[model samples]
Target: MLKIGLIGLGPIGSLHIDNLTSGAVKDAELSCVCDMRKVDNPKIADIPFYSDIDQMIKEGGADAIVIATPSFTHFELAKKCLLAGKNVLVEKPISLCTADAKKLEALAKDCGKICAVMLNQRTTPIYKRIKEMVSSGEIGKVNRVSWNMTNWFRPQIYFDMSAWRGLWKGEAGGVLINQAIHNIDAFAWIFGLPQSLRAWCKFGKYHNIEVEDEVTCYMEYPENMTATFITSSGEHPGSNRFEISGDKAYVVSEDGKLKIHKFVGGSLREFTLDTKYAFGTPETVETVEEFEGKGGQHAEVMNNFVSACLGKSKCDYDASQGVLSLTLANAMLLSSFKNSEIPVPFDDELYAKILAEKQASSELRKEVRKDFILDFKKSFR
Candidate 1:
């Protein structure tokens, strides 16, 4: 078994505790825990709990650590563990900046320890099937990928409840980085990274926060494929829809169902050139599929991390996958901020300059607020 210490007891961290204790993850034990606030759960009533992370790092009993902390604290926390030669599983976006994320990646490689991210959306069977189909040419040359994930609706109190909930200096970014990032990760998983992008985002569109809540971006990928991504916390009764239009088929996943239409004829380009008809489309076959049952999301991520640490299996949710999502989010953000199209492989230094400038003026109100809200259920794309 892989002895584990989970740091941070935020809502997600607390949920993870239940999952880990429920025997959902095989070959794992939540032997230790550390959080700034008191963890009063019955599940971990006897496990080691520390209010200070440094103390836990020094004396906590564990072979590996799971970082379920805030966005900005990931790199530093993982840095300590990597230096200690312990495996780590960090939450999404990995680090606030690509450079910082890269540093952890290099450190993990240098230390020869397993480092994974909590991209649990990848564990979803629907997305798993989508990735398999795209890789198997079921889509046959993706030409357009558009995802409108506007279902993340947050009220003002939700933002004001925590200082780092939605600030550039705090949570590092908003919708694209925080809420709809699963979609971003899923997009990258299915389509890979794009070559260039142009984005537009609105700050504080519906809340008192200092980061973007509404965003729309256009991106271009390899082989002239293109995509449009839009997300918002401002729209109520919003919709979660993912659409991918490729040469051979069009697939969409929405409302808990997967729908696809496969073209029976040759590629559209070939048909367009050979056909004598002015405007006629090819015959197509449509299929709709749905997946049932859950697959141990967060717990599965932890189990995979433990298995990888034991050299039994490799964790696919490594720093590269983490960086891919962060890179796309950062590119969209920097592009929107500069009001210019940004090329792929964005300049990390330039992004640092931009984020620093934004941080310079950001004023996140400090307060002795409630550390944890007991209601532990929420959803996002």
Candidate 2:
């Protein structure tokens, strides 16, 4: 059996534990769990638990490691695990910066170890079908793509649970890094990366966080194809919808349903019998598809990672793919902060310069107080 070690015991980490122990991996066993907090659950009672990750990896005798820690720590932890000669599965937004992500990718290649990212949305049947349809030219040339994902709502209590909740220096970016990363990944999966991006984001709009809460980004692609991404954490009764329009048909996802409107040949009667009606005449037909699954993206991600470890399949969201989405997110944030369009294949030098300036700014630096640092450290412990 493939022995595995899981780090971090937060919500997502707990979900991975459940999946690993709940027969999600027929040939795998969760031999060890390393978290700062003590878990008393019966599921993990017999397994080894350690506060130090490196010690647990050495003493617990695990063949692979799953890093479910916060986004900022992903790079360092994943690197450490890979250096120890263990396969790794890290949660999304692989790292806070693109350069770190690239370095990890190169390290994994050198070590010849499996490195995967938890982008579970790609495993959904609905999204997979949508990708197939788009790839097969069922929609012809895509003219426009729009995603409205504003349904994410996290209260102050959720933020209060950790000091690194919404600060740029701590969590990197705001909603784009935390809540919208999945959608951003999905967009890139369905439609390739954009050549350039222009965005406007509101910092500390609803909550008292230092990161952004509302954002609107415009992505430009070749051949005049464009996409608009609109998201907010401030609105209630929000909606999650996506619309893709092409020359032959259009697809829309809303309220857990996918509707496709395709232009087909007119019916025999319509073509034979001349109808004077203009507005009532129907030239297209609509089809709706429904899907049902665990709905928890984390579970799906874990299952894929385990499958990859067993050589049964490959990871749907590999670390390299995750880097693309993260790069796009970083570009958007940089564009919003600079009030200009940021070119893709991101300018690392410009991003570094901006980060340095932000870190040195006295007004922004004041937000990281002693209490904030304590709370942030508590979560990692």
Candidate 3:
């Protein structure tokens, strides 16, 4: 069995502990857990617990380490794990800055250890089928893409539960970085990275947090295609719709269903060129597909990580893939900060410097609630 050590006792981290201890992940065991504060969960009562990561590392029973701590601590923790010759699976965004993310990725490579991200959405069938549809040319050349992912609503109490819940200095960003990051990563994974983007962000729009809670971004892709991303942490009963318009078909994903309208006769370009009438359009066929379940989610990722660490298979996703979405997030945040369109691989060091300035000047105070109960299901998309 592949031995695993878990860090952090938050909701996601707790979920990981449950999965490992419950035998939900094949060929893996939870050797230990670490958190800054003492964990009182009975699920891990028999497992070794440490308040210090260094102590856990020095104990050295785990073959792989899962870093599910807050966003700010990912870089240093992951770096330490990799340096200790441990495979790592870190939570999303990887780090608050792209520069740190790159360093962790490079370190993982130099250490010759597996480094993965908790991007569970990658295993979802809806997104995987959508990727195949678009990449297989079933939707022709993608002309435009739009995703309105505002269903990630968070209340004031949610931010108050933790000191770093919604602070720029703490989480780096609010909705885009924390909540909508899964969708953003899916977008990048399915459609590939954008060439440039322009964005508008509202800081503390619907919440009292200093970071952005509302954002609208327009991204430019190659082949004359474009995409728009709109998200917020303030909207209630919000819509979660992703639409893509292609030359031969139109695709939309909403309410756990994928709808495709495939045009008959020919692609839009051909139809426009050879149409007999000025206002006539091509015939269309519609197909709708609904998905059930969350495609195994976090457990599936951890299982795969275990298999990778055991040399049974290659890691389905790794830190290298995690960096793509981080780059997109960094570019959009930088674009909104500069009030201009920014390139895809924008200046990572420059963004890091600006984030440092923001962190240095932040004046937000928090009422950290150690007694607050966490509801992990509500946080899922």
Q: Taking the tens digit of each residue's C-alpha lDDT, what string does model 1 give over 186-224?
A: 888878888899999998988878889999999998888
Compare the candidates by lDDT and give the number of the best one: 3
Candidate 1's displacement at residue 75, Å, is: 1.2
**Which 10 consecutive residues of model 2 have the lowest summed lDDT?**
372-381
Give the per-residue lDDT of model 3 (tens digit) for 92-195.
Answer: 97888889888988998899999899899888889999999989998999999999998788888888877787887789988888988899899999998998
What's the lDDT for all of these models?
0.85, 0.81, 0.89
Candidates ranked by lDDT: 3, 1, 2
Q: How many backbone overlaps does candidate 3 show? A: 0
Question: How displaced is residue 262 in candidate 3, in Å?
Answer: 0.7
Which pairs, if any, clash in model 3?
A: none
Question: Which has the greatest TM-score?
Answer: 3
Candidate 1 residues lying further than 4 Å off, grouped into runs, are: 368-375, 379-381
| Candidate 3 worst ten-residue window by lDDT | 363-372
